[model samples]
Target chain A: MSATDELVANNARYSEGFEGPLPLPPAKKVAVVACMDARLNVYGALGLQEGEAHVIRNAGGVVSEDVIRSLTISQRLLGTEEIVLIHHTDCGMLTFTDDEFKLSIQQDTGVKPTWAAEAFADPQEDVRQSIARIRNSPFVPKKDSVRGFVFDVATGRIDEVV
Target chain B: MSATDELVANNARYSEGFEGPLPLPPAKKVAVVACMDARLNVYGALGLQEGEAHVIRNAGGVVSEDVIRSLTISQRLLGTEEIVLIHHTDCGMLTFTDDEFKLSIQQDTGVKPTWAAEAFADPQEDVRQSIARIRNSPFVPKKDSVRGFVFDVATGRIDEVV
Candidate 1:
């Protein structure tokens, strides 16, 4: 199916009928930091619902500058108190070398790359490292809880990494 | 069950003794922008496997500063050539007025509120707006595809929003 068709199909299968506004929950303040891998469904894996947690995702589920900023806002501005960082197994971020990725893009688009190399290496270790970065980051409330996990995509399981 | 128990259960159910590392398809490099709402399971909804597409998530699935940064890296540095932004219904980001949220937080934490009225507002509209922002974003390749949708927490479905 075309991308648009796939989207529409998925939407039709998953979205229909509900029209009213959502009733807010009392525990409306948890956050999850997860990878951008489509295969790892954070909700189904964790058995969560809307308003139960705020999710933050990026490459490797690493706590980058953007994660810190959103997390800060989620906590200070939106009232979230807990954060769960979820990285996954067999991640693409764990696969290609920077040069290979750049070469593929260069061949596909013929455009010169602008970003540096250190950005895409060792995704698993990156997740482990991000946990420490987030824990030590000044932006996150010192008392706020932060935990890390690795989601095994094949098994629909998550392992606490830190 | 604890997270570890869940992992163990899933592993027992799904893992075959093939042990030489799970064989995965070549990463197709798609980007997914989804809500941090724990209820929306992008993986199960999409039937995705590990090492498939990249996922980017934030509040209301809104594209924030960090989302853009991640997108830049995903497209320019990583191999993603398409983007899917997934928003959802019944999102907490839409549930309360800024003042109400601040009041609730203040009452809970007993901290002097430094949050602003502009902090909280319409979530559905915000998600649609974020999709537009991403489509028009200079960081995203013009020819690279970008689409937006809304996942219904009640129905476990997603609707194309833009």
Candidate 2:
């Protein structure tokens, strides 16, 4: 069986003990933008219950146009008031530059991508960058508590980016 | 105190019992594109442990350009082979139309967004849309086991969209 099949089986097991249908809006009034890193389990690391916050993630957790779109809907429609951004140590994004990654893809496929790969040199700096993107966007209205963090993958701790 | 502050406190508790970092690449060789629904805890519902799979989320779990970017990195830079697309029932995306959402944002912000809101009438149909996107993308090379599902929020069950 593929790994997908195993997860499906696990899903069956999860549903057996599940009690859900929580409210649609986030209870904690917060939204978290974190990297789609496999090891950075946002729920576990943040102690976030299922209905507490809107979790938006992507390659580097960088605030791309899509992230702004998500956050706009999260705050405007779902009533989330605060925003949290997280980038972690040893991220795959740090391994390559945008130009290199796009060039390699272009060489392989013969077509260049229009979007930026959003690779960054430092996670903490990217965290701040993500925050600034959120702050600058006119789409997302709630910004009183927009904070960023660098999660220590080795230690499972998050240091706030000031 | 702000919700962010409370989550920071929770993070302190999480780190106290947390273990060191696991490997960077996903162990299960899978990447899940899921909706940023507050109640759709991808980890709990999928029974995914840390380091198992890359969880990419957004407003509607729609296959946007950013998702393609993330998947390209996942398959090319990392080693993920299977792709799981998940859209859940009772999502906020269903409550509004793209035109309505865009107009509302334009009215509130005095500037219209270039991106679509990605609202949909049905989760199952959108699941098919998401699957076709990955299948058609030249950037993502591995497409052997691409699957889609509609997560039932009430029952915590994910029915495959075959």
Candidate 1 wrongly placed segments (more than 4 Å): A15-30, A43-54, A69-82, A88-125, A142-145, A151-162, B1-29, B47-51, B77-79, B95-120, B142-144, B155-157
- What does candidate 2's lDDT look like per residue over B1-162, in tens digits? 889998899999999988878999899999999999988889998889999999999999999999999999999999999999999999999999999999999998899999999999999999999988988998999998999999998999999997
- Predicted candidate 2 versus true structure: per-residue lDDT over A15-129, tens digit per residue: 9987878999999999999999999989999999988999999999999999999999999999999999999999999999999999999999999999999999999888888
Write candidate 1's Cα lDDT for B1-162 as tens digits: 433344335444443421324334316567777766555656656655445666777655667656765676677655577777777666656655666755665666565344242333655576667777787655566434677777766676666664
Candidate 2 local distance difference test against the native: 0.93
Q: List the residue pairs that clash in candidate 2.
A: none
Q: What TM-score does model 1 score on chain A?
A: 0.78
Deviation from native of the Cα of residue A87 in model 1, angstroms: 3.1
Native-to-model Cα distance after best TM-score fit, residue B29 in candidate 2, in Å: 0.6
Q: Residue B161 in model 2: shift from native, Å?
A: 0.6
Q: Backbone clashes per model, in order?
A: 7, 0
Inter-residue clash pairs, candidate 1: A11-B158, A14-B157, A15-B157, A15-B158, A36-B54, A36-B55, A55-B36
CAPRI quality of model 2: high
DockQ of every predicted complex: 0.28, 0.90
